[model samples]
Every structure is written in structure tokens, then in C-alpha cells.
Target: MPVLRQITTCTEPSTVVIERRVRTRDRSVDYRLEVCRRHRWLASNWTGRRSAEGSGGRCGTVMDYRPYAQIVQSHADLWLRPLAANGPEDHDGDLAAALRAGFEFLTAHREPTGVAIALEHAARITEAIAAGALPLVEGQAQVLAALSAAETLDAGARGA
Candidate 1:
């Protein structure tokens, strides 16, 4: 097996790294997922290397590989839910804060060019929220749309 590429995305408490490898014989793609949460790690589709601890290796246990989109969607959902939830009177402020935090995190990990769409969407959402133009539900929809569009664009770039 030859290593291919790896991408990482992060939100507050978690960071997910997806490594894509291809088998030379059949040209099949294999996804290896690694997640870090508050300094703890969980990995899937591990390479079967044993650690000194020998408890299935560093990440604790191994799991089967999952589709790339599935992994991205799950992580996005987990991170985006709070932006959709009800909050105090300062809900819009909270939403803007959340968006800013997410944008910063994404910027730090991924290339600004790669995540330009997401950054644009986040700016729009926060601007609307600040200007009192977006209600909670509409804001959530826009966020979802933003993520969908970004994912679609990324997939297309990858020729997937």
C-alpha cells in the first residue's frame, strides 16, 4: 500500500485527521481516521502496529474505515449543533462567537484557500446575525448549506 494524502479539520474540543491511501494492485482507496479530543486519541483502520502498552496500540482500539463524507458529516454535525440550539437573549451574539471560533480553528488547521467558501459563509452568517437579519432557524439552514456546498466543492476538486 502506498500512502496518498491526509487532511485534518478541527472544532473546539476535537480534531479529526483523515488519511487516504491507495492500494497499488487494485487502486482502492483506504481511509484511516484519527481523532484527538482533549489530548486523548481514537483511531480507526489502524495499521496493526503494536505500541509499547500493547493495548491495541496508542488509540486504545481499532475500528473499520468509514467513508470520507460520512466522517466529515459526523464531525460537522457534532460541531455545528450548538449553532442551531436555543440560547439566552444573546443568542445571536453566541452564534457569532461560535462562528468566529470555528472560523479561526479552521483557518489555523486548513489552508485559507481551501476553506475560503466556509470562511465566506461564516462571515455572512455572523454579519446577518449582527445586523439582526437572520433568525436562528435560517441561520442554521445557511450554515448547513454552507457546509454542503463546501463539501461538494471539495469532492469535486478531488474528482470523487
Candidate 2:
């Protein structure tokens, strides 16, 4: 189980909740988190920081490109299929775990690049499964492949 931490930003009275869902043998147990940002200032401030830093704000870098809330919401969106099928209440634990994992990963990485990468791969894999290109039981394989691709790209860029 991933630890859940609530981090309050210094600039605003906003609380960012980090949740993580442990992976289970059941695919339905795979969870994604939803991030809700109530304050507009946070988003604007994050954008300003990214621009000032000259970092693309996408990949692991010096600054966060997307507000923490957006990152959470986006991942939730990406992981929608499972959530919808299992119902939110049924997957709350896993959702919390996934959120924690995402928060930790983004905090350590400092880049939100994984959002696009994961989203892209998720869409592709979902489509493949629907079309029978990939077996439904191989969903974990799809996730691993996506992660591997992202890591490979990151490694290649670093090597260059």
C-alpha cells in the first residue's frame, strides 16, 4: 500500500492529496487517482514558474509543468475504464494508492511527462484490447510496455 500524504502549498490555501493504490492480481484492482484543483491561482502560478525557468515543464525537469491537481485529474481520466467498470467506491483504496504513487513519482521526477506517455499508451492499449489485437488478460503487459517505452526514451535522451 502506498502512503497517502496531504501537502499544502505555501502560496495558497490548497491541499494536495497524494494517494497510491497497490496493484493486485485482479486487473479491476488497478486504480487511478483524481485530482481536484479548486484554486485558479495555483495553475497560473505553476505556468509562470515554468515559463520563468525555461524548462519545457513536460519531462522530468527543474519545475512542474502541470499543477498537481491537473496531474491527478488527468491520470484519473486515463484510468477511467477500470473505475467506471468497478464503480468509484469499489476502487477507492486502489485509487488512493495510485494517487500516492503518482504524487511521489511527480515530486521526485519534477516533470509531468509521464502523463502524455501513459495517456497515449493507455489509449492505444485500450483500443487494441477492444479490437482483439491484445488479450484482455494482458493488460499488465500493456502497462509494462508503456513504462518501458517511456524509460527507453528517457534513457536515449540522457545518453545523447
Candidate 3:
């Protein structure tokens, strides 16, 4: 049997909950962390310090991008498949997880052109998901695919 643990922290503007299943015999840990940011104003205005032109304004540098690409690659299927099956409403939790992951990524990385549109998109998506009002758009999969592909490219460039 696996041991399950959960921790929830409520801050002023955000709350994070993490759940993990540990298999003691195998010494493996499987964890799912959910970050819920309630401060729309703050999240919307959050700016990434990195310039999209690469590391330190240098081109062709494989600067590290965080959770957005990683989240898209890992959890895109979770959001997309359910939309085709029973619809996202049936899997609200999974959908939220996917959206939150994407939001985390968008907030952490600046756009290639230094635009804040990505942050706006992230905020919109997060709100839609939170309200259970997200439309089942046809292009959703394509966007996720694009993000995932970027991660692949980044990995290749990094020689990983």
C-alpha cells in the first residue's frame, strides 16, 4: 500500500495544496501540487525579469524556461482528452490542474517580444477554468501542442 499525504497553505493572495503518494517499499514519490492564485490584479501584473531575446539579451542562447513548457508537455493530454470524451466539466479538477500549470509557466517566462499578452492569456484561462466557463475551443489542442513542441526544442538545444 502507498501512503498518502497532503498539505495546504493559504497565503494572502494565493493558496497551494500538494498531495503526494509515497510507496515506502519502492521509495518512490508521486506528487501533485495545485497552486490557486486568488489575486487577479497581482497575477495579471506580474512581470518576468528575463528578456525573451535569450539569456542576457543574447540570441541563440538556450536560456532556461520554467514550468509553462514543462506543464504543457506533462499535463496537456489531461486537459485535451477529457474535452473529447466527457467534456471538461466532468474533469474539473484535471482541467484546473492543466490550466494552473500553464498559468505558472506563462507567469514565469516572458514572451519572445517582451509582451505581456501571455500573462493576460494565462489570467483569462485561469479565470475561465475557475469559473467553469472555459469554452471547448477547437484550437486548444493546437496551442498545447505548440507549447509542448517548444519544450522539445528547448530540450534538444540544451542537449538533454
Best model per TM-score: 1
lDDT (C-alpha) at residue 78 in model 3: 36
Show where candidate 2 strays beyond 4 Å: 1-114, 144-160
Candidate 2 lDDT, 1-160, residue by residue in tens: 2112111222222233222233446322222212234432223323211122222212211111233333334335433333223212344534333533443444454655554355456546655765787786575345444533443344344331
lDDT of candidate 3 over 1-160, digit per residue (tens): 1211111122232243323344556534343333234322222212333222211211121222223333343334433232223222344545444443444444465543211233234435555644657653423433343333443343243332
lDDT score at residue 76, model 3, on the 0-100 scale:
42
TM-scores for the candidates = 0.32, 0.25, 0.24
Ten-residue region with minimum lDDT total, candidate 2: 55-64
Q: Which pairs clash (backbone N, Cα, C closer than 3 Å) in model 2?
A: 19-96, 19-99, 19-100, 20-96, 20-97, 20-98, 20-100, 21-97, 21-98
Sort order, TM-score high to low: 1, 2, 3
- Residue 90 in model 1: lDDT: 32
* 79-150 per-residue lDDT for model 1 (tens digits): 334332322123443544554455555566666544445645755775785688998556655654565455
> Where does the lowest 10-residue lDDT sum fall in candidate 1?
54-63
Roughly what TM-score does model 2 have, to 2 decimal places?
0.25
**Model 1: how far is 26 from its true place, Å?**
44
Error in Å for residue 18 of model 1? 20
